[model samples]
Target chain A: AQSVTQPDIHITVSEGASLELRCNYSYGATPYLFWYVQSPGQGLQLLLKYFSGDTLVQGIKGFEAEFKRSQSSFNLRKPSVHWSDAAEYFCAVRFSGTYKYIFGTGTRLKVLA
Target chain B: SQTIHQWPATLVQPVGSPLSLECTVEGTSNPNLYWYRQAAGRGLQLLFYSVGIGQISSEVPQNLSASRPQDRQFILSSKKLLLSDSGFYLCAWSPTSGHQETQYFGPGTRLLVL
Candidate 1:
């Protein structure tokens, strides 16, 4: 069985500060990893995804995630977060040869002034 | 360009009532469709998925059922709604060919069961 774990339930960061959301997954083979963001009362938007390539993958809205196979982690990061960046983040994993995505519990981001 | 649409942005239903939610995709053909539910403060739970019309696969066994009448239309239904069914339902589509697996999501429908 494949599963994703987001360690942080909630994270508060000041405007213009850097942000990092932790995510770990358990899978038997190389996994397809994705990061998605959801605003209040809105559907999720795909931020970035990693199929197979460079470890670091850039995504929309200046977001990026690095896939670390040895550690089974794919953490999302942003150099600077704006107030508008506040939202819920989720990490999802799909093992090769599978179409189903296993998602993490998600981390709520709160940007402060 | 491809887009996904889900109807009834918000819905309120009583327990034991029948439920129906519609999802449709545009600008794509032979795409894989999926139905997911997100409970309050929880991650997405995939309810069902379809590769083609009349080909539906359920990931979870619950009060809901799914149907695909057309290539782009998917429906979720329930004979009797339950309180646990109250959640945000999302419709997503992914290209089955080209080896692409990224699922694009719809605006979603929020359901409240009383």
Candidate 2:
């Protein structure tokens, strides 16, 4: 079964500092990875996705993720953290040409001023 | 540009009461629709998904059911609500024929079952 895992349950960072959230998935031949962000009491918004080609993918709101095939990891990163960026982040994985997507429990990010 | 809508934004129901949550998609047709529930402090649990009208797929054996009556309308229902059903319900839609793209999400409807 294909599954995703977010190792860090909670991460705290100072504003204007670089941030990275780790994600790993069970080994699969063709894994389509995605990152989503959810504000408190709001639905998740897609951050970025990786289907094929480049290992690094850029997304909305100045977020980016690098899909490493060898490690089965898709880690989300930002050059600078903002107070508004404090939210829950989820990593989802889906096989090619499939409807099912397995999501991680999520990592809660806290940005300190 | 496509959009998904879920309502009534928030609902409060008593245990054993009936439930009917509606989801619809616009600016697109024949898109795949999905129903997911996010329990408090937990990851999202996919309840159901539909590829076409009247073709619903249940992911887990649960107390809820879903239906896709029209091309763009999907509904989640339960005959008698349970306290476990209290959570945030989210509706999402993806392309029926694509590269397994990202699913677009609605604002979500918070359901509180007392």
Candidate 3:
């Protein structure tokens, strides 16, 4: 039973401000973690992913995430968010034995002017 | 380069009507295909997945079924549509031989059940 939880349902941040979205997962072993972003009425796009080794992972669109094993958390952070960054973010996990992905409830991001 | 395509960007069907959503992948072979449903303002829910042709694994039991007629073709069908089935349906594919796999999603099909 692997699952991911995103504590924030919605987050509003001003343009040029730092953004951090929280994500926690419950898995027995070292999990494969991913962060995806989806615009309204569009498919999801990969933001970043963590398999092993480095605790921090960088991805496209200037997005990054840190995998904290002790806290069971993989939070996404951006130094400066633009208006185009406003979208829904999802955290996903997958185990070694399966190909299916377990996704978090998702966090809606709103960029304020 | 690999790409995924799903047809009928948006669909509206009545209850008890049948469903047929097609998904195709290009520039890849023997990909692991998946069907996912997402409700408004919710996360993605895995409905089914396939490793090869004629092989389908269902993650959740519902009024939905999936089929892989070809190595790169996946289809989601239903004998009778349900209101709960109205949502955004996404088709995704990933490499079959990877430890840390990342799925690539199609443009997605929005379904509305009346």
Candidate 4:
């Protein structure tokens, strides 16, 4: 069956360190990919998304994701982590234009000053 | 520009009590609405979605029920609340037209069942 996986359940890093969150999907065809961030006691905000062209996609708050078809991965990256960036990140995928979205188990990022 | 609204930002109910949560979307039309539950330290679990008024599709079999009385209004209810029903409830809306599959989420409603 098709699914989305986030191997890391929790990650901690020092401030100003680089960050990478992995997202892998199992699907026959190309799917729509998205990354979202949620702060404590709040709703989720869209970080980035990938549709068709351009493997590298940039998003708000200095975040980017690269979509690799061969590897079936869309990993999020940040050059320098901030203390305020400590939050939970989620990866979601949709096979087609359908309304249903499959979300991965989320990864919680903790930043240390 | 579209916006979503969820009422009763926080709710506390006892077990066996009834549940009612309202969600409304403005600045758009013919949107695909969805309901999701997010437990503590977990990702989102899709509960229900609606394409049009009075048309609902349940994703999981649970004690929860959803209804779409108006085009932009979606409500989630339960006849009797369960201990497992305590979580953060979110309402979302996506456009039906265009290939824009992005979903806009509303401020979640936190439910605590005692």
Q: On residues A65-91, what C-alpha lDDT tens digit does candidate 2 reach at each position? A: 999888899999999999999999999
lDDT of 4 by residue, A22-60 (tens): 999996566999999999999989999998898999999
The TM-scores of chain A alone, one per candidate, are 0.97, 0.97, 0.96, 0.97
Model 2: per-residue lDDT, tens digit, B26-88? 999898899999999899999999999999999999899999999999999999999999999
Off by over 4 Å in 3: none
Q: What DockQ does candidate 4 score?
A: 0.81
Quality of candidate 3's docking, in CAPRI categories?
high
- Which residue pairs in candidate 2 have backbone atoms (N, alpha carbon, C) closer than 3 angstroms, thus clashing? none
For residues B9-105, could you state the per-residue lDDT of candidate 4 as single tens digits? 9999999999999999999998999999999988899999999999999999999999999999999999999999999999999888888678878
**Model 2, TM vs. native:** 0.98
Model 4, residue pairs in steric clash:
none
C-alpha DockQ of every model: 0.79, 0.77, 0.86, 0.81
Pitting candidate 2 against candidate 4, the one with the higher lDDT is: 4
